[model samples]
Target: MKMNPLKVIKNGVITENPILVQCIGLCPALATSTSAVNGMGMGIAAAAVLVGSNVVISAIRKFVPDEIRIPIFIVLIAGFVTVTQFLISGFFPELDKSLGIFIPLIVVNCVILARAEAFAFKNGALDSLFDGIGTGLGFTIALTALGAARELLGNGTIFDIKLTPAGFQPGLLAILPPGGFIALGIFMGAFRKYQERKAARQGKPEPVHAAGCAGCAMSGQCGAAAKGGGN
Candidate 1:
């Protein structure tokens, strides 16, 4: 199918971000984002795999049987993930170790699989490549920003470079699991608010969130509340 490369790129990076906006790949986004270096490394590795898998999938989309498409996509994604893992291990051992299983785990990451099913399987190879790059970059940006924030707050440093003044007592929670959740929540909220403000400034209606708490444990309550408000 024909697609605008620029629009695909923009959609993945900003309009439909996999991490900050769509909220996919939260597993790695939260687990490996304790530092900027770790986060950036993970993000870049994932991006490489994404671009590779997207291109391959898009190229062979027509021939693949619809019934077995999921299996084929998994294999393709797995291959790319394996290659990315080895590359990182050979070139950036520290990051490789820090990311650990998460690298290999990219094979099963919804971000890759979702893109394969939603975009690559339907779009041209070139468009799929751009989509992969855009989404991957967006993922990278989110991870790096979250990592930087956590590292700075938790250790008074970013990428292990000390930034705070001497004697600064960093918050231990910022680098811990709790810190990850809090930081993620804060960032997501901030991004949504920013989007809202931007839309307002441009005289556009507020963007309707795609997920809209559908995956939350409290989805039932959320639905009820929405209906109540509507009434």
Candidate 2:
């Protein structure tokens, strides 16, 4: 099948979103989203790993045996994560420290693996690259949104700069792990409601179930039996 770059990108950004939709990579999503800077740093790091791993996986998909495909993908992902970790440490030590173990943890991120297995394995190099970029950006966007919300409420600041009135008292809970779960849940719920309302407004047909009683022998007289009985 020919790969469509636009479709691939769109999938990562919306349809197959790794964060708000798919709910993958929650570890870093929660841990690094305390501030915009930290969230952006982690997102970029993960994006680099995703893009590199997707390209490598796509290039080797034809030759890889299905039995060992996952192991191979893991190795490639680990290599990219290692390179990213070193580069961040050498050039952006503060960010590296802020990110901590999450950098290496990128190797195990399900979003990267899901893309590699579901998209990259079947796609050409260019298409896989596009998918990686889209998915990475989607992740970054979600993390940034979460971070902004958390930081604003938790510290009364956006990027560590106070924005609230002098008398404002920060909500300490917003920066905690519980706050991450709460924010994510609220976002997901709201998104789902929006989709439902949109579908209703568009007059979309309800989806049919293939496993309904109409197709089952227990529905009453079976199709064959009904015809034969009448005959």
Q: Estimate each model's TM-score.
A: 0.89, 0.85
- lDDT at 117, model 1: 81
Worst 10 residues of 1 by lDDT: 210-219
Residue range 1-231, candidate 2, lDDT tens digits: 776788878878876567766767878999999888888889889999999999999999999998789889999999999999999999999999988999999988878887888778988888899999999998998888888889998989987788999999999898888998898778766766665676688898532322222322123444446557763
The best candidate in terms of TM-score: 1
- Global lDDT scores for all candidate models: 0.88, 0.83
In TM-score terms, candidate 1 sits at 0.89
Candidate 1's C-alpha runs over 4 A off are 212-231
Report lDDT (Cα) of residue 65, candidate 2: 99
Tens-digit lDDT track for model 1 on 155-210?
99998899999989999999999999999999999999999999999999998775
